[model samples]
Target: MAELANCPRCHALFVKGPAIVCNDCVKREEEDFQLVYSFVRKKENRTAAILDIVRETGVEEYKIREFVKSKRLHPAQFPALSYGCERCGAEIREGRLCESCTVSIRSGVQKQGELDDLEARNKKEGLGPVTYYTVNDDNR
Candidate 1:
């Protein structure tokens, strides 16, 4: 069901559906995407840096970064283009977080793994098996 809500981008009344922003904002974003795409499609412009593209084509850097993040822009073709890490805001070619953040997350996982291993080892060594004794009805 669509709910009546104000558009986040333009603050206009719009039906809230699958899209985050209103139709007008979506149209504007499409136009921006087309403009950015046209600029980067040229062989000469393919190697241009994100900042340079922004300066030359008048497209916002964040839009280009969004394209990169969404896999709309291929990094192999555009060598000078990179997106900011979602965590540290450092530049990276692929993925949301940068290498440092990735390493930090990995270290955390390693610590968790160590704790899990220790718990399992303790459970195996500390717990004793329960002894069951069965009495025959004839004996009773």
Candidate 2:
């Protein structure tokens, strides 16, 4: 069998590895990566998320994702600096959704609130005091 080669994007493959393209593809990919990395590293945009980076730079998410992984890159030195879910504040690392959020979403078929359903159930069953919920309106 033919020896594997690195993909221009990932630089990895099985016995017949990836990156079958010649030097030109590699060079182009590298240039694109530099462009993206440079943009992401900018002081004004270092904290941008994957979508923000793509939208701001006009690069496709697909290419941006590839560059992020292939380059082993981060939006910023501090993980907290990286933009993430507005709702959960999860550290996305690369993609828009964090691993935890993704798992949480996948675990349930129907999209629903994290705690809304439980609270609704407790109210329905009249398990008021035992139910987990806020007890103070003005007592705070």
Q: Pick the candidate with the highest lDDT.
A: 1
Query: Per-residue lDDT of 1-140 in model 2, one digit per residue for the tens?
Result: 57766555556553443546655666776777777778867777766667786777676776776554443575445242344454486645566677878787777644556466776898899877353576887977
- Over 4 Å off in model 2, which ranges? 1-18, 75-140
Per-candidate clashes, comma-separated: 0, 7
- Give per-residue CA lDDT, model 1, range 1-140, as digits (tens): 77999987789999899998899998988888889889888998999988899998787898899988888888887888889998889999998899899999999999999978877887889854445899899977
All candidates' lDDT scores? Answer: 0.88, 0.62
Candidate with maximal TM-score: 1
lDDT: worst 10-residue window of model 2: 78-87
Alpha-carbon TM-score of each model against the true structure: 0.79, 0.41
